[model samples]
Target chain A: MVISPSKAAARIRAAAVDAFASAGYGGTTTRDIAARLDMSPAAMYPHYRSKEELLFAISFEGHTEALKVVEGADRPGEEPSVRLQELVSTFASWQAGHHSLARVVQYELTALTPEHYRTVVALRRSTTRVVREVVDAGVQSGDFTIPDAEGVTLALMSLCVDVCRWFPAGNYTNPEDIGKLYGDLALRMVGAA
Target chain B: MVISPSKAAARIRAAAVDAFASAGYGGTTTRDIAARLDMSPAAMYPHYRSKEELLFAISFEGHTEALKVVEGADRPGEEPSVRLQELVSTFASWQAGHHSLARVVQYELTALTPEHYRTVVALRRSTTRVVREVVDAGVQSGDFTIPDAEGVTLALMSLCVDVCRWFPAGNYTNPEDIGKLYGDLALRMVGAA
Candidate 1:
C-alpha cells in the first residue's frame, strides 16, 4: 500500500488533528498520532519531525484555508449586508463542517512555536480584516447601522469562530442550517436596511 | 505554616487552572499542579485524589458561579431588551474577567468524566434557558423581532461564552468594554424595537 508524499502527509495531518483535538496539543505526542495512523514513529518522522512541528503544520493549513474561505466568500461589489451574510455564513458553515479539525486548529494554536504562532496569527488577522472591510463598507454606505466598526467586526468574527465550539447542539446539527441561521443573524447584528 | 483545608483546596485549584490553561488537562498532572504550589503530590492527594477530580471540582464550581452570575443579572420584571442587555453584558464581562478560568472550564469539558460532564452540562443548559426565556418573552411582547428564539438565544450565549477565547484583543482590553459591546450587540441580534 504505497501513498504519494502529499497524500501521506495529508493523512498524517488528519490523524494528528484527531489526536490533538481529543487530548490537546500538549497532551498528544507524535507517537500517539503515529499510532492513530498505524504507522511507527520512525515511519512518521519523515513527514513530521516533532509534535510542535505537526501542530504548526495543522495551524498553518487551517488558518490559511480559513482565510481563503472568507476571502472567497466576499463579494466587494455587493451590498454590505449581502456581503456580510455571505462571509459569515460561509465561514460559519466551514467551521462547522470541519469542526474537529477547526477545534484543534483554533484552540491548540498556543502550542505553536513563536514564529509559527506569528505566521498563523497573521493569517487570522487577514481573515478578520476581510470581515472588517465588509462591516466598514456597510457602515459607510449606510446599509448597516452599527455602533462601532471595530467592535462590530470583532463580535462578528467571534460569532463565526465560535461555531466550532457549539455547533451540532440541539437543532443546529447541520452545517448548512448553521450557515442559514448565522446569515440571518449577521443581518440583524448589523442593523441591515 | 498551616493552611485551612478549604484554603489549601482553593490554592490547589488555582494552581491547577494555570497548569491546565498552559499545558491542558491531558498534558497536566497532579504532580505538576502540586509542584506549582511547592507541595508534594501526596499532600495534595487529600483534597483531589486525581487530576480528573480536580477538573470536576473546577468545572462544578465554575459552572455554579456562572449560573449565579447570569441568574443574578436577569431582571425579569424589566423590558426584555433591558433584561437581555444586562444578562449579556454581565455574562460577557464575567467571561472576560475570569478568562483564564473560563477558558479551562469552557474548553476542557471533553476531558471530564462522563458523569461530571453531565453535571456541568445541566448547569450550562440552565444558564441557556434563562436567556432563552428572555428572548421568548421579548418576542411575545413584540419588543424583539427574531427569526427563531432558540437560534438567537444560542448566538447570544455563544457571543458571551467566546469572550474567554478572545478578550483583551486590540482596544477591547477591559471586561466592562467587552460587556458594553456585547450588550449592544445582543439587542441587535434580537432585533430590539
Candidate 2:
C-alpha cells in the first residue's frame, strides 16, 4: 500500500500519457488516469496538482524529446545539402517512431491550458526555426532555392506532422523507408537536386 | 415554434459541425449544440435521436462535400497529369475555404461511431484510389515514371491534408499554393519533369 513519491509520480505520468494520447486531453479524466496507474487520486495529487498538470508534463516530455532528437542529429559546419538531408531524415524517422508522443506535442495544442499552450507553441516555433535555418543555408549556398523559405519550412514541418497522423509504424515497419522518400522529396522541393 | 423536422435537423447539423470543428467532437455536447442553435435540449431531440446521430450527420456532410470536390473536378481523357493538377487544386481550395468542416472530416475519425467510422474510411479509400488512378495512368502513359504509385498517392494526399492543417488563408493567400507545388512536385518526383 506504500509507494515511493518518485516511483508513484513516474507511474502517474506514464498512465497520464497513455490516457491523454489514447483518449486525448479533453476526453481524459484525472480519475481515469489514476485508475490506469492503479493509484489513488489523493496520492496523484502530491505529484500533479490536477489533470492539466499531468497534460503539461506529458506535453513537456514530448517537446524535450523532440528537441534532443533534432539537436543530437544536426551537426555544425556540415555541407548544406548533406546536412539538410540529415536533418529531414532524422526528423521523419523520429516522427514516424515517436508518433504518439509527437501527436501529443503537435495535434493536442488546442487542449492545453492557455499558459501551457503558449509554452508548447514557443517550443514548436523553436524547432521550426531550426528547419528554417537549414533551408536558408541551403538556399544561400546555391544548393537549394525554395521560393519561400518560411513557407518551405511550414511545408516540411507539415509533412512531418502529417506523418504523425497517418504513418502506421507496424504497417510501415521501417522508418527509413518513409524518411528517405520524404528526404529526397524535400531536397528536390528545395532545389537541392 | 413549429418548424419542419428537416429544417430542425439541418440546424442541428450546422450547429454540430461548428461545435465539432472548434471544440472537437469529444469536447462538444448536445447542450452546447442546442445553445448554438438557440434551442433547448427538449426541442432538439425530436430532430435527432442522440448526439452520435448529429455528429454522424455532420461528418457525413463533410465527407459528401469532399467527394463532390474531388469528383466534380475530374474529367477523363484530358491527360492524367492535368486531371491530377485539377484535382489537387480543387481539393486544396475547398479545404482552405471550408477549414472548420474539413477539420471535422479529416482529423476526427475516432470521434465517429463504429459504423459511421467505417463509412468515412471507405470514402477516404475511394478518394485515394482516384488519386492512384491518376498516378497509375500517368506512369503508363510515360507522363510519370513513379516506381511506386501508392507512395506517390500518399505523398499527394499528405500534401492536401497538410494544407488543411497549416494553410493560413490570410498570409499564404496564394490560392492552391501548396496544392500546385505538390502537384508539380509529385510529377517531378515521378520523373514527369
lDDT of 1 by residue, A1-193 (tens): 8899899999999998888888888788888989998899999999889889888888889999999999999998888888999999999999999999899988888878889999999999999999999988888898988888888889988988999998789988999988999999988888899
Every candidate's DockQ is 0.84, 0.48
TM-score leader: 1
> In candidate 1, how many Å is residue B30 off?
0.6
Instruction: List the candidates' TM-scores in order.
Output: 0.99, 0.91
> What CAPRI class is candidate 1?
high
Off by over 4 Å in 1: none
Q: What stretches of model 2 exceed 4 Å from their correct place? A: A1-7, A169-171, B1-3, B173-178
Q: Which residue pairs in candidate 1 collide?
A: none
- Provide the interface RMSD of candidate 1 in angstroms, 1 decimal place: 0.9
Q: Measured with DockQ on alpha carbons, how good is candidate 2? A: 0.48
